[model samples]
Target: MSDLYGRHKAVLPDWLALYYADPIEITHGEGRHVWDADGKRYLDFFGGILTTMTAHALPEITKAVSEQAGRIIHSSTLYLNRPMVEMAERIAELSGIPDARVFFTTSGTEANDTALLLATSYRRSNQILAMRNSYHGRSFSTVGITGNKGWSPTSLSPLQTLYVHGGVRTRGPYAELSDDEFIAACVDDLEDLLGHVRPPAALIAEPIQGVGGFTSPPDGLYAAFRRVLQERGILWIADEVQTGWGRTGEHFWGWQAHAENGPPDILTFAKGIGNGMSIGGVVARAEIMNCLDSNSISTFGGTQITMAAGLANLTYLLEHDLQGNARRVGGLLIERLRAVAAQLPGVREVRGRGLMIGIELVKPGTDTADPETAAAVLEAAREEGLLLGKGGGHNTSALRIAPPLSLTVAEAEEGAAILERALRSRVQ
Candidate 1:
């Protein structure tokens, strides 16, 4: 191992996951690519878990952060910050929640934490509902709501969390049903769970379960459940950390796929808004957001530099209509990958919307997850000068592809070809 790798292993937690056996230190990046410490160029398809929103080292984002840093970097939330207010205004308008109130945080975990605080306080209930095979964040509170066994490390939590079904469409009891039937069954399950437990403060879900290998229920599944939750005054918290800001191609927000009822009551977002800068936030109507009796402030939540980065990133994303680009390019990429998956027996499913996609790895003949080969594929792809990400329910066997929203059709084709080679070489 390299000296840096040795130091990392020595200092970092043992559970901190690294992609390849030999991790490459990324030195610099521009556009859709990044260069490792040894001066090797690679197509960064994962985009730092989809945080590098528009592109890596985009000039606009760089200029904004630089300009803001030169002026004022740190002004605590106690003081007024112009950039923070401006960015929050933009987000509130885009968030689709009526009379929305925006509160920024440093990461998705904090945003969800704040959301949970608001929900429980507003509803006067400590009981919470979370979708099965879903991942929200890593904090103590967020972990309690995370239903994925691989990600949730502890069962101890301050609040009582109940796991609900219908997050994954392919490998569950509802897998055999049609889309409409699947929605109905999931709604029935949610109703049954509600009847058994004390009324939950909220039902937290990701429109597309990100760390669960990009799996999602059929479209409109959440809408069906919304009606049931509405009657009981249980808030619907849409964890848009990975699925927000038009990454999903067809819709600006993943929840738009299920817009039959309306937008979610509370929405938590992060991981893409400020590109590489740390920025996460929660949006809710004025009433729910004002429910907190105690004063709450995020120390580094909406720093001027980060807000500048966010404003710049959002501007570039909207002005250039990168959302449209995601739709056109991601559609072609998924189709190409589906064709490739058809030829590979180890491939189980090619799924996702927009730039967010997942290729599930399985034993060639059996339906069992093949994490060993999946790791081999990740190693092979890195060796081929392409970086990818791995995620799934308990197995961690799915290849995640989420290039920047600005990914071109040519880049998509190139990444797909590299992925095809990686899969073929790894799977028997």
Candidate 2:
């Protein structure tokens, strides 16, 4: 394995990061547990960066993919693709956008990029609005809208992006305000920013900032902001790459938590829907989606096999009521983790919804982020046969926990116990 790791480093890009000091090669997974190449079993907490939404190796999705592959694998969008239409129809019905149109992509980056393109084309402006400490994707255009300094590698972009406040409720200047007050302040800021610039095409945001350590503003913040944007005819784009597909437990989509102004003009989703297959997409009103004058297609998007797998995965989760399972199981898990966090001084905050949770660590008796301690806890968790993930705008100082939506109560308790032990190792 070490030899393979050495070879991986030699061949892979230097920027592609791996978890743990000595990364474990995951050989296989079932339910909420995965086994490494060394045959050590571990509870999976991060869900492959919140992508393996359903349990790993779900038989229904596997069977669907197999059957589809046996019949046909790939057909360019120039030809009719039944599975793609079926998947899109289901998504459009569930999207809540009136007269919705769905466009498939190969990854979240492409989905978001498509959203940007449609917004810019429809509104005829190159300006955009984003949230502070938010991450959209790694593509050049998506990265331009990313406000996280750690993730945005370049300042150059085709679009003029203006970042807004109120994404994080705990650390910013308006952190001390009440919920209503926070929303007001953010809206005022947005209005003020607009006064100084050209009319922007749209405002893009995540209901819960994923790479920003699962932090989010008070509910209705976006609703409040949307009111201001709508007056100016700016579209709202909800980036649900990590927060979609009932991963948050409380709602089918994270945007529902702030549906006061109704659904966003455009919604981008990826991760989890295909349950490990490559599937990403954008949903919007027909007007916005059809704004483009020229035709465009994603070569690898909506392949027959992937669409079949996605359709089966979506059906299985809905039929099995996995969202309800996420709600019940995630509620208990968060309460358990909160109880544990209360005793640990290094733990600053434990925040999230459903299976998507984040534990922000800070130096004891200080407000500064403690990335070293967070990294140490991650290593300790791995040693104890538990896999975890790290994220945060503050040098990756938060521990992200997003297990499969089907995680059992027993698995949650076990993972919590191991994590408690790992966290306590800091002071012991």
Candidate 3:
């Protein structure tokens, strides 16, 4: 381990995971590339788990943050922050929730936590329905609802959580089923589950299970589930931490893929809106948002600096049509990756929408997940100056590829070549 790595281990919790056998210190980043402390530049595919929505060190965002900082950096929610109000207005309109209200938090975890609080308070139920192989957050309430065992550390939770199926469409019992049949089975399962438990406050899910190796059900599965939820008055909370802000290319929001029955009752978003500034929020109809009787405010949630950064970042994203860029580039990248995966025996599947793709590695000629091979490939990719992320259900068996919305065709081609070399280097 490097001296810095040793110092990090000494100070930080062991549970806080670090990537690579030899961890790297990214000293700086620009565009799609980051340079390590030793000055080795790697094309950053993960983008800090998709937190850097636009390009790194974006001048617009930096200027906004700096100007805001110069004016006023931290003002608690008690004050009328213009930047926060303006950003919230834009987000409310873009949220797709009619009569929507937005409440900011510091991170996706806190945003989801607030969503859970609101749902339970509004519905007067602590029961929550979460998808199997799902990841919500690291908080007590979120961990309780998280279906992925690898991340969920404790069973003791404030809410009654039930795990449902259909997140992974490739290896589950329903994997063999057709898309229609899979949706039917999952909906049926959800109905059966509701029958057995008290009415759940909400069914919270990521349209694309980000930490679950970017796994997703058929496009309309959540739409089917939404139909069931509507009848039962169960709120649907789309956890769009990783899938929000047009990262998926085809849709502005991940829930749009399942928008037949209208948008989710509550939507939680973080990671990208601030473009590296800490910005997260929950949006819902005014009715649900106002359900909380007592007053509450996230102290540092919508500070002027972060909100300013968010406003600038969001403006740039919309004006530059990064979503459209994602569609064009992400489409080509996925096709390129699939072509590469086809030649590798260990590659089980190459799937996901737009830039949010995943490559699942498995033992050659067997169904067994090969997390070691996945780890090896990650290291190899790093050696080839390409940085990627690893995630999956329980075992880290899939490589996650989610670059910024500004990823170019040339950069995508370069990343794909490096990834192909990394995959090919693995001994099946």
1-428: candidate 2 lDDT, tens digit per residue: 89989999999998898888898899999988899999999999988889889889999988999999899999978799999999999999998889999999989999999999999999999999999999999999999999999999999999999999988999889989999998899989999999999999999999999999999999999999889989999999999999998988889998998999899999999988978888999999999999999978889999999899999999998998888888999999999999999998889899999999999999998879999999999999999999999899999999999998989999999999999999999732
Per-residue lDDT, model 2, residue 141, is 98
What digit string (tens of lDDT, one per residue) describes model 1 on residues 1-428? Answer: 39999999889999998888888899999999999988999999999999998999999889988898899998889999999999989999999999999999999999999999999999999999999999999999999999889998999999899888899998888899998888888898888988888899999999999999999999888898899999999999999999999999899999999889999999999999979899999999999999888887789999999999999999999999999999999999999999989998999999999999999999999889999999999999999989999999959989999999999989999999999899889987
Residue pairs in steric clash, candidate 3? none
Residues forming the 10-long window of minimal summed lDDT in candidate 2: 419-428
Which residue pairs collide, candidate 2?
Answer: none
- Regions more than 4 Å wrong, model 1: none
Task: Give TM per candidate.
Answer: 0.99, 0.99, 0.99
Question: lDDT of each model, Cα atoms only?
Answer: 0.93, 0.92, 0.93
**Position 167, candidate 3: lDDT:** 90
| lDDT of prediction 3 | 0.93
C-alpha lDDT of candidate 1 relative to the true structure: 0.93
Give model 2's TM-score versus the native structure: 0.99
